[model samples]
Target chain A: MALKGWKELPIGGVIDEPGKSREFKTGNWRVLRPVVNLDKCTHCMLCWLYCPDMAIEITVNEKGKPQMLGFNYDYCKGCGLCADVCPVHVIDMKPETEFLKD
Target chain B: MLTNIDLKKAQAVTGAEAVANAMRQIEPHVVAAYPITPQTPIVEYFAKFVADGVVRTEMIPVESEHSAMSAVVGAASAGARAMTATSANGLALMHEIVYIAASLRLPIVMPVVNRALSGPINIHCDHSDAMAERDSGWIQLYAESNQEAYDLTILAVKLAENENVRLPVMVNLDGFIISHGVEPVEFLPDEKVKEFIGELKPVYPLLDTEHPVTYGPLDLYDYYFEHKRQQIEAMRYARKVFPKVAEEFYAISGRKYDFVEPYRMEDAEYVMVALGSTNSTIKYVVDWMREEGHKVGLLKIWMFRPFPKEQVQQYLNGRKAVVVLDRSTSFGAEAPLYEAVKSALYEASARPQMGSYVYGLGGRDILPEHIRQAFEDAIEGNLLADEQRYLGLRE
Candidate 1:
């Protein structure tokens, strides 16, 4: 997108476009990525609730039951907040380089 | 929702009460304020209206002035008509958020009951508090009397809410002199005021769930300068928008207002430029001087934030000399009003000889005689070499 001049900006510094946060790839700043162990997951959705970046997604099962879909790294900075808040140690923060090597 | 208003009745009340009456008539959506000396009565009176159901305003009695300003910013950003009042140290406390509100362009209206800023601390009439925030990018209107205090408060809401100039506005009234002193004030009826101010149509409200928005984001070198340029453009827009709004207000009230009010400046040889309640005494002194065959007049600055450069130059260009009366000292530097008026005149084709006098610091009393002497000194051009002339200060 072309950069707007000073006069073209919205009044009062208001960012009018919805979901413009998606344009900023904060995932580039992530050093560690969360690896979720789906087998031992309790489906408590605590990590989904605690994810500061709203990276965690929840999906519905065949019977319309809710299930954890782990994290989406598009906008997440991988702060390990979800790993810290997990009840059963279902998630672990792994170095991004190590995950890439795997 | 414009109701039929009666403009004939007048009530005797203090400036604070007058402003409160205006607030009750306008009936803003939110008012978040912390009480301080002199400004306390304004919010206190409005709070009673809230309690008594006279107005359906959500009054947030915040713990501190900072929080009060912050709450107003939040409310205003959410597309609500928000307002607050403060004085002296309270204004000092809300200093940070004051700039934020303006930069965010929330259109929050505030009444600043002017009082002296502290070192030893004073609770009297002075412009130190409002002067401290002169460069905060808010539109400032100074009131010389209780009636003006009430009128300007109502008008400030309309000015700030203007789509082209979506900046915060402050109405200043002298602390004890105007806030506490009782005087006769005429008010427009509630329905007429509602029609005059119109409705609050926010461009991009945070509360609009379907169309989301972000405010106060981190804009570094990439766009910070551009954003500041946008704010300046808005201020420029205010210079044009103010008169249009004032004209609409005049239609209802039959009282006309201008950015700078020139009193007897047409053929005067010397002029005195001042702000706030001091102009009243200066006008009286000018009349006395005129009777004595002295060609002197007074220029009262009703709007100080936009600075009214062209209007000021228009009135003072041909004058022999001009004296600027500043109630607040700039400490080590020249007084704020003095520096502003002097710089504004520098661009004129024919610049008048200018002098600065700093007076009434910490609520020092300024008598008519003191103003008379200032005008006389300006006419004589006696203090041309003096850096700063001190007025009414005991040696």
Candidate 2:
């Protein structure tokens, strides 16, 4: 049994499904994830705006390369808001249905 | 299923009593209210419910409408299903906190017994009080009759509490006309109402000791607008959630309401826009006018805050002209509601020529004939010259 208020992994790290909980994986699941092409991308953060769970983060480099951040699947329910709002077609919602592969 | 519901034999009650009965059914955790005309009976019945143990809710007798709203906001933030009722000047008094409740995303339900705001005070019904705060971040539902008033009160709670629509809602019932007028209102069982509402647990409520977060944060000019923008987003979410909530309510309660109710508008050459109780009278006139081969219609706006701009745009796309009836005046300027309808029409791809007429100030009785005249006038001479047309004032 887990210690009371203790024995946890990193926040937004891998989370164990609670005992007897049903797995609810559906939709276009992306495993490797969509990487942004910064030269063609505008940081409109429409992906960030539409994210229901606030999982997507946008970071900039010294050269001002705006990159679409990766997913924290522990926190992400796999809702493809990030893909839907990718105005410049930079971030693609590649299927991660393999995560549920036995 | 609900073969148990006896719609006919339900006791005849006023709008206030219907609201009172609905409140009793929900059994709120706390009720903070101040007495005002027409709105008094709802709080009175709630107080009696507390006394009789019909509802295990705490009845807080606040000194003013400000404190009434303040108390409910505090209670609601603390994870209690808080509620209150006020009218006219009282709702106006609770003004500042109304925006606060919605910003904090507190699912507080307030029944605004529609009354005229005072200057030379007259005790009467008008949409002036509710319409004054039309831009406030709260879902607004205007009821045409006592039954809708009662049923909408219950529906307001469900809509306001939904996760997608975690915002406050005010159910506006025109004072005296509906608040005092008796009509047979079906009373749903408390268990049935409870089942429909499910549980009252708010997401990350203020009272939770395990995980805590600050609410109603003080934002500077930089953040304040963004916070309000988020509120606008929430209101948009609410617009979508409202119909779903009402559909669920209808499944259980056998009552229904559309945000914007249209009457005989399919082939309307001319139409009238109205809110609150005036719609009831306008509907009657529309039906009568249609019988005489006139293509007149009425669009009654129930949900005002998340103004159904697109919905109204779609409905009024091909109309020749629309006469918006404003219950409250904007003094030297155009009526506030008339301005909203005009603005909404402006956004439409092809909007009909819309005109506004200010009517029914300080509880003046608006007759069906006045509605008929407005329809006829809009159709004829295009009497769109005056931005303000008084409804029932002696010339």
Candidate 3:
């Protein structure tokens, strides 16, 4: 991103626009990524409710009912509280190295 | 519009109560402060105002000194006109947040009652506490009396909230001496204070739902320095913007102040520089020595943080002798005010033979005879740059 001069930038590093936090990706900081199996998943939304960063993405399927789509890797600091909160025990925390090795 | 039929009456109150009265008059949106000695009375008095329904300020009785500052920072960020008060240990505890308050450009008006920083635990008057945060980017105004304390607290709010100078301001009054001692302080009426304070008009406040802004955001190496550069520029702008705010304050109260106040220095051959409540005692010495035909005067540092460089140089330049007194010792340093005075006169055409005195620490009584000795030393050329003297300490 192009940087603004001190005078050009707003005072106190306050991001003036909403959702500007999305620009700064935190997924890189994640060592453990939460992965879920859609086959056994009950879509209880507990993991969605428990995610600290709001990294769990929710959307509507063909039936138009809200369903847990997947993790929004753009954020998702990989705290693993989301996987722990899932009652069905289908979600798992995997090492980032597994994906990087691919 | 100055309202109320009865106003401008000087009330007999201590510096703490006077400041609380000013806070009452300003009626800020929030006051998040923890109680501490000397400074506790300020919040207590203001709390009374809150209880009586005199003002509708959201007074947050914070758990700790750190939380007190944090609460104000949060409130200020949310577009509320916020203020806080603290003393020695309390001010020290809020150290981390103090810098954040300035860097974040929150216009928090805090009145600090100057007390001795603990070291074996002593609670009395000294500049040690406020001096610790001298470089914290807040504009520090030291008051010599209750009236100035009252007036400066009001001026600080106006100066801090200025668009060009969105920095926190610390108004200092001497602990016990000024904080507890009663003096007649002229106060502005509530409507007049409201008119003068006007509105807070915070920049991109979090409370504004339409304009969502993220405060205290993370900026890495790419932009951290530049953000600090903005704080630097804002402080420099405050030096220029202060007089305009003081001008507005003067119009209502007929009281005006400057960075440095020179008392009887017009034709003086010997002069001394000092700050806080000590100036009141120093002035008495200035008056006494004037009668004896020795041309002696005092340059009281009204504003400490900015250091009032030019005015200090302008006042002390070409004088035969200059004595700088600090209530707080820098431990190994040459002392904060003394070092500043010397640096100010570094580029001047002529320099005065200087003397540095570290006096009145931990609330030691500064006697006239002791003040007389400093001036007499200046007269006799006994003062040396390297040899720093201590008043009231038998060594």
Pick the lDDT winner: 3
Candidate 2: tens digits of C-alpha lDDT, residues B161-181: 887668899999989988999
- Model 3 per-residue lDDT tens digits across residues B130-203: 99999998999999888888889989989999999999999999998999998877677788988998988888
A34-74: candidate 2 lDDT, tens digit per residue: 44566776777787778786567668878886655665554
TM-score of chain B alone in model 1:
0.97
Q: Chain B TM-score in candidate 3, rounded to 2 decimals? A: 0.97
Clashing pairs for predicted structure model 2, backbone only? A29-A95, A29-A96, A30-A94, A30-A95, A30-A96
Give the Cα-based TM-score of candidate 1 against the true structure: 0.85
Alpha-carbon lDDT, every model:
0.88, 0.78, 0.89
The reply for model 3, stretches above 4 Å from the true place, is A25-102, B1-8
Local error of candidate 1 at residue B94 (angstroms) = 0.7
- For candidate 2, the clash count comes to 5
Tens digit of per-residue lDDT, candidate 1, span B217-308: 88767678888898898899999999998999889888778898888887898989999888888888988989999999889999998989
